[model samples]
Target: MSRNQRWDFVRNKNLCYCCLEEHTVRSCRSKRDALLHSYQATEEAGNATTGSRRPPAVLFHGGESSKALFRYIKVQLYGRNCYINTFALVDEGAACTLIEKDLADELGLDGPEKELCLRWTGEISQTEPASKLVNLQISAANQGATRYDLKGVRTVAHLDLPIQSLGEKLIKSRSDLKSIPMPTYRNAKARLIIGLDNIKTRENAIVGVPLEGRELEGDDFVAVRCRLGWSAYGRQCSGEASRPRILHVCECNNGDRLHDLDEAMRNHFALESLGVTVANKPLRSKEDERAACIMEAKTTFDPEAKRWQTGLLWRYDKMILPNSYPMALGRLRCLEAKMAKDPALSQFLMESMKSYQEKGYTRQLVREEIVSNSNSWYLPIFTVTNPNKKKTRMVWDAAAEVNGLSLNHALLKGPDILVSLMGVLIRFR
Candidate 1:
């Protein structure tokens, strides 16, 4: 073809390089469709004759890179088409796919329906539950899109996958030497990240090196380790003391390895958030020993047991925060007198006391005595019916605002409160 004619052909027509056809790449899915149709027909025939047909497993690979292989894909949101890059991270540990909120916003996804507090693996602090979930259509290049449900988090940032110094230099040189053609790589960032929840299908495969050279069996999942750390520029935050550490996650198959790793992580005993390495040296005095606070917790609610659980609390000073307004000053009304006046509330209080005593949360009173008090915190009690059951349980109104003041902080504010109150039924799982 003439130069001008070739240019016109390239610009005007979609060319398939694989088959040297006049269709865009991946446009011809006849082979795939035919295979799928044949499989479906066989499945149907088997179901009719043999009562059921076992479906084949769908597999995916993580490619040579630890990150799951990425592809240029088109996503449909609100009936509009948006082409973006996507990849899967085999968070075989987590149950749901999570997308970056900004990427979702660009794709015209609505705000999260509700907020949830959660934690990522190796995180010392539980993240503020700011992620929302939505469903969208995602497809491989030139293929029909499929519905994919994902949880969207505002905190999911661009992962700077580490590369060799030589690789980095080559990429920079290539960018400088020529005009990069792909729009996606101009400012490359993965827009979508699929997780194990959506990956439970037979259609997707996990590309990975199998342990023991055997195909993955039940609960066989992939894990990868990467270096993670950060530093600040100013003198206040500078120094090699802020060195990064290896963050590794193995979700499945390697039970012994996971157990040992978990034990090691717990024993590392370092103040991770501040980068302070914990030492075996003993503190010289009680005054020198600082209290450790629990900041994050993961819990599972059981409707059958009527409880919430799964966290441990170590020894720490159990004290309420100093009261700003003293009750001994006679600024607040007496709750003892109020409880006596209302029989229903009084009974609820008695039941709560009994429950607390039974669960080892509180000790039974030895004798009734008139004790003078400052800031006499009177936590009111109420009956809460379990939605899944007809049974009613006594619940203290700790969140209630009393005289425009709250004593929620005065109570054990973290996982300890839950751990203390719920007995064996709520022990850490």
Candidate 2:
């Protein structure tokens, strides 16, 4: 049958489109069962592939020729009175430095096992239990005088860094690039990744400089100066050369599985009873009592305005507010600059402020009143746009702080006046 005819038949029969059952689509069990089965199959397949409970080493191939260049430096890792010289890749994207497990083992490094959730390209994440935080000292192979301590460096079974041969011929052609000591090996293996956590290592690792004369503009290779020596990075002219590919790996240390299990256990053993039950009332603090008393004393109802005006519940009776005018003025200037660029935004904000004045929510302060009020605070206003609603709202920033204190900090939060959900449900019933 045609799509429209099938849909019409299901609607007339008041049957589920998913299962062709008596119930509607909302009550269809077939779709839910199919989704559950698919999830289970995926989980089982993942488990079958990762028998060792470790994520399999993922390799990404970049076209035929790997012309791109990566920053690699030779560093000597010292741990447990053993030192091993290895090439390390400078990856600023990685949060923590990672060393190969074999390299860590060779250096006699051992630490507490850590569970990590590693996410690769395409948002594919897997929980692997084959990582540990190890402490080691690293120094440049050329400059061994300054040894930097690297603490909490994670050890992984494999870095999954692609093997790319450096462009030696290109390096030899340029006089300036050839002067620096660059890696000339056919296949260089980077066993360690120097991340931002190793600040000293990163600072001394790679420093780029433009080549002289014609080599600066048209040259494919760029030479970088490192503490260990010089390194060249750029695309090679040879089509046969493998194209360099970057390994995008993100490490998450938060134990999501344990948290999930905890949540599941809590749900399984949750209290079955519903609605309000007899229980001791939670005691209010001295500050809460003071806030309540302050509100009770200062609150006044205006019959003409049909609104209640209440004084702020100040933390201290004689609390001195900091001068926030400068900050507010700076914020206002920034808003004006933004509004100048966006005419629609400017119109929306002007309309909102005009509405506020018309509704008596705010008023234009006279020059005399502005000068007279020494302790007055100016709230910085900003616009929040809702694209779905096609609306823009002006928000007064009460939490914009100056000297570690804001309008919210000075004023005590009044008593909770929110009605209980259970009480409302019981009343409805």
Candidate 3:
């Protein structure tokens, strides 16, 4: 429609600006249908390329329905020209350059020289190893396909979509920029993300909108930002603000001196454990406390050997159970306690013993068999009803000793016993 006719429709007859329809813009069905089709096409194309998609000879351009725009550039790897699809973003806070494995394989990049440990990406707190680094020349955008040499680029398996930091410096330098379009992807694009390692330290806390607190859940602490870009709410560590007012300082001794003495003592213990011949000297002066500390314990995993080793002293004989509370029945006292607790349990026990006899878990002992064996270990078998199922379950208490030795101590306990048999409770703040 002409400008004069459009103005006449807006002044005389109320109509939508988008489609010049009689209804308001809020009720525009055509726009909604177009958006729906765009999203559906993206999903269908992604699903179709699951197994048998051909390699792209040129860069893919981001369409109108895309969340972020993309650019395709020619990358020179190993004296050959290769096309790489990439997302050019405004900001990619504190990230390094990364390349995907598939592109690296196609480009004939070598195996990884060393591991790359990445940190601080949503829910990914662990370090991930990267493949071998390679040097490449990538065609610069808006510079008429001018090639620039980029070195030490690392490759990873899932580095398909990379957000290249673009208007970050512009936003920082210019206060006028309210929001910038950050590059993202719904499907595979660029193999490499440039300028990731160029990240700088950000402010401790960003200025946010007013927010309300919610009921806390989950074990690990997480900082959650609201939809309004306001103050985050999640589990946070108790700081000085949460601490009590009362405080005390004792001038007992120098902490550095105490630490030195402790380290010297540990080194001595380690040397003794190794059976090294050394002179035992009493610490006479402050100079004696200044000795070097023992090296910290190290654990190493051998990928080839498929085993883990720790530089810790082996203590095969001694056991370190968390809690060591005493039991009610001990050393042949179990049978008498069982009889006193419940006599019906005795009848159930006898029935279970008969069943055990049939199953060969337990057998009837003849007089000759008893006489032939000088040392006998008599273990009590008991039964208890499960509350949930209301069914009787048998338990062999080998720890009920005949001659003061516990078979339970000698053998490894179960997944249940590990929890149930604990004598101490530890609570972390």
Candidate 4:
């Protein structure tokens, strides 16, 4: 039939031209089906190009799913006498690797004992005294040609990984994850933990691939490829009403500064033996005497101002200071930029500097003085704040070095003149 005749026939029959249905062409089911098919084809093509599919949505049992996932692998640990194959957890969050104490003993591994404080989840703490540390070699259970050495591996009583077992049905369904070797029925116990020390090393790099579109009994997982071997880690659904258990272990050296404490105690007791003993006067070197004589000659008291003025005690009479004007100018420009951003800080700094000037602590340099002093040092100034007291103080940085010398380095260090606190307290009593 012609186009006009077909259209008229469809209109007269009250049917859709696209599907020959009773509805109009605008609401035809065939058009919607065609669009849905096209979208599915595009998604399939994208998944094929990426060699992975989108992960399936998790199927909740009752209200919510509390399944936990952890990285675990089968490894062969080589000890002194022989080697043992066991499951190990790869935790990059852990600072150090750990092995089961019983397993360590079985392998005849021995090392120096150390005291460590172990902290676990739920604010639990344990002090492990004389904990043995050992060195071991580890390799993949399937591939043993390449081995990685783990040094200073700590020993723990037990390493528990409370994760559900991976069934063979899940592995057989996915081709990409079929290569991963896992236990048959029961979940293997994780007797060892490989920490960040091994995972971060270039020799033992690890890569992870999410096992998308691979779900069995509402469980999702990811496959990890490392120097060890292919391993699977993800949420495991047990169809039970229980919370997931995750193990997080941290260890630190327990009171390693006992030797320093013992030394301090000995010194305190020794001081008690010499009661009311007078300290000998410190002997002055020729440099100290010269510096003292120079200070005495240059120092003068102003009767009107009620203040004393003195010149800097130079280490050498002929040594000239390097020009620090450029450094000081750069620092001042940086400070100005910062102060522009904070008005309160700028006001505080100005007030502090004005106070210093009023107390005769600092003086403004004249144009003639700056021109004459070509090789003079410039002390940079900065502000420090006490957060507890909510107070700001200005500091003059005399320790800023220029050309391997600073103001502090050029000046002479006088003899110790500070009185002991114990002597002062005794005299007051």
Clashing residue pairs in all predictions, respectively, total: 12, 6, 6, 0
Alpha-carbon error at 201 in model 2, in Å?
6.2
- Candidate 1 minimal-lDDT segment of 10 residues: 227-236
Go through the candidates in order and give the C-alpha RMSD of each one to the true structure: 31.1, 29.2, 30.5, 27.9
Candidate 3 C-alpha lDDT tens digits along 66-159: 1222232223333254454343211233245566667667766565465665444332433345556776554422234434454566666674
User: Candidate 2's residue-wise lDDT over 262-372, tens digit each?
Assistant: 898677545443454656765678888899889899999999999999988888887778888899999999999999999999888888889889999989988777751
Candidate achieving higher lDDT, 1 or 3:
3
- Per lDDT, the best of the predicted structures is 2
Cα error, candidate 4, residue 15 (Å): 67
Candidate 4 per-residue C-alpha lDDT over 1-429 given as tens digits, one digit per residue, 9 for 90 to 100: 655566677678977656777776776656432321345668788888877656577744455564555676777889998999888888766777888899999899999998767777666877667679898888878654577778788988766666455668756766656755654435667888887666644444342122333334434755656667666766644444456455677776435457767888888878876775555855679887888788789999999999889887888887677888888889899999989999998998999889989998888988777762634778898989899998888889989877778889888885445776886887562
Candidate 4 ranges with C-alpha deviation above 4 Å: 1-66, 173-176, 179-185, 201-219, 237-242, 253-429
TM-score of 4: 0.43
Residue 302 accuracy (lDDT) in model 2? 94
Report the Cα lDDT for candidate 2: 0.73
**Model 1 error, position 412 (Å):** 48
